[model samples]
Target: MPDTTRARIQQEAARLFVKSGYHGVSMREVAEAVGVTKPALYHHYADKEALFLAMLEGTLAGLSRLVQAANSQVGIRLQLDTLVYELLASAPEQRVGLQLASELRHVSPERRAAFEQEYRRVWVGGLSRLFEDAAARGELRGDLPPAMLARAFLAITYPLVTGAPTSDPQGTARALLAVFLDGATPRQGAA
Candidate 1:
């Protein structure tokens, strides 16, 4: 199997897996979509599970890089803003990975566990460190646990990526961050 063929297969398979659920797609269909023969696809990935895992790994790797780059900067507000904008910009690609993660339980228990562990190590672990750094810097509210705050932030802002009608994801992200950083209610101290 040539490296280019394998890469092509992985790219196309990831796209299809996002469009259709894991169970909804078949190896033969992937091969056809990639314009490769079934045997050629098999030569690269012995089975659908192998292909799926490769796609998951690639997605996780991309996400890990995105988070790490954002965390490398010091300011909590800047970090959060960078993360929000990147996530919103990459929503379509990320949505596929999120859908796969949500549906991972349908995979065999052993593989599912492995997938989950990798997800935690890459996504959750990095997030935990970033939030903890923010707290240690006294940039975040002391009353909130960094991990809890990180999850809440993600929950609150992710919808903008999926639901917002605007063309500017970055602008939408900045506004969403304002809501999270500030509050829905008017400040009592305001004149």
Candidate 2:
């Protein structure tokens, strides 16, 4: 119930979840990691599924805010660059969001659907709007549909976030951005 207990549980559970997949860790292991009894952990979270969802919700909330903030900025190029950096700069713990995303199919149908819906609503929908706005302003090529282009951009960068080493995340991010932008930008005279 206390703030510290809740924070500790989230911190420990996130660590264990990243190190071991959601199905791999048990309540007892989380309890030991947090220095709390199983009953204490249960008091805060009804079950492992509940705790996993909480961690997932928190990660998505952070990412959604980041994307929304970038979208609100003045320029589309800046907005895209900001999103790239945010995704690339995510810490190892936050990287679990990508892993969990891939593993969501293994979760219960209800939770899996819910996760996918929220992901689309937040990340995909936001990206579509950004591309549309950019195209309207002549900041991006107008030939491609915003929704399709948004999906393409996400497809290009998701792998780097999920599996690439952190040694040069920024560099990888720049290259990915360059590739997408180069294709999306209209040339001066090309039809």
Candidate 3:
């Protein structure tokens, strides 16, 4: 189903939620923002948390596809570069939707757990496969665990993925890859 109203609700709600945090945005505000009556909005979503979860789940599922496609490239380095570039290339609203996962603090514990399962299954699991392969091949340095390595990559680059204007995504991808694929320490041959 095209379901434009539902999609619009998610889009508008995302913009509102991004501008104002989970607690900051309310159902009435979301309804107003979406130009839908409270009854209409409630028809689509049970309540605020459900709407929030739907938005988050939808974004994460799309991102999971992007990550999988990026991972199709020959090597992990190329994949990482593509992944960061793809994310940076995504619309601000979409990036904000991805970042909204961090706002799980306000939702019920059950809701939080549900989102966590989807996040881990869709978002983190998409990236974890690369590290798992790399580790199996003994390509990853040190004692890095596959899942931890994936999480570390997210920890390092996500701020840029959602924050301030990025003048150069390729350059940004390169810098992030440098720190993640390489390290902050000086090269062995550096002066």
TM-score for each model: 0.88, 0.85, 0.86
lDDT of each prediction vs. the true structure? 0.79, 0.81, 0.83
**TM-score for candidate 2, residues paired by index:** 0.85
Order of quality (lDDT): 3, 2, 1
How does model 3 fare in lDDT? 0.83
Q: Which parts of model 2 have CA positions greater than 4 angstroms off?
A: 166-171, 184-191
- Per residue, candidate 2 scores C-alpha lDDT tens digits across 1-191 of 68889879988887787778787899999999999999999999999888887778888887788788787778876787788877778745457776665556556799878987997888888899899989999988899999999889888877777675568766776777778887657788989
lDDT of 1 by residue, 11-119 (tens): 7887787778788899999999899999989888889988888777877997898798788776877787888888878887776676666667667799888988987
Q: How far in Å is the alpha carbon of 143 misplaced in model 2? A: 3.3
lDDT of 1 at 139: 77
lDDT of 3 at 148: 93
Q: How many Å off is the CA of 62 in candidate 2?
A: 1.7
Compared with the true structure, what per-residue lDDT tens digits does model 3 show for residues 71-112? 788778888888888888784755677668778788899989
Q: Candidate 1 local accuracy as lDDT? A: 0.79
Q: Candidate 2: give the clashing pairs.
A: none
- Candidate 3's TM-score: 0.86
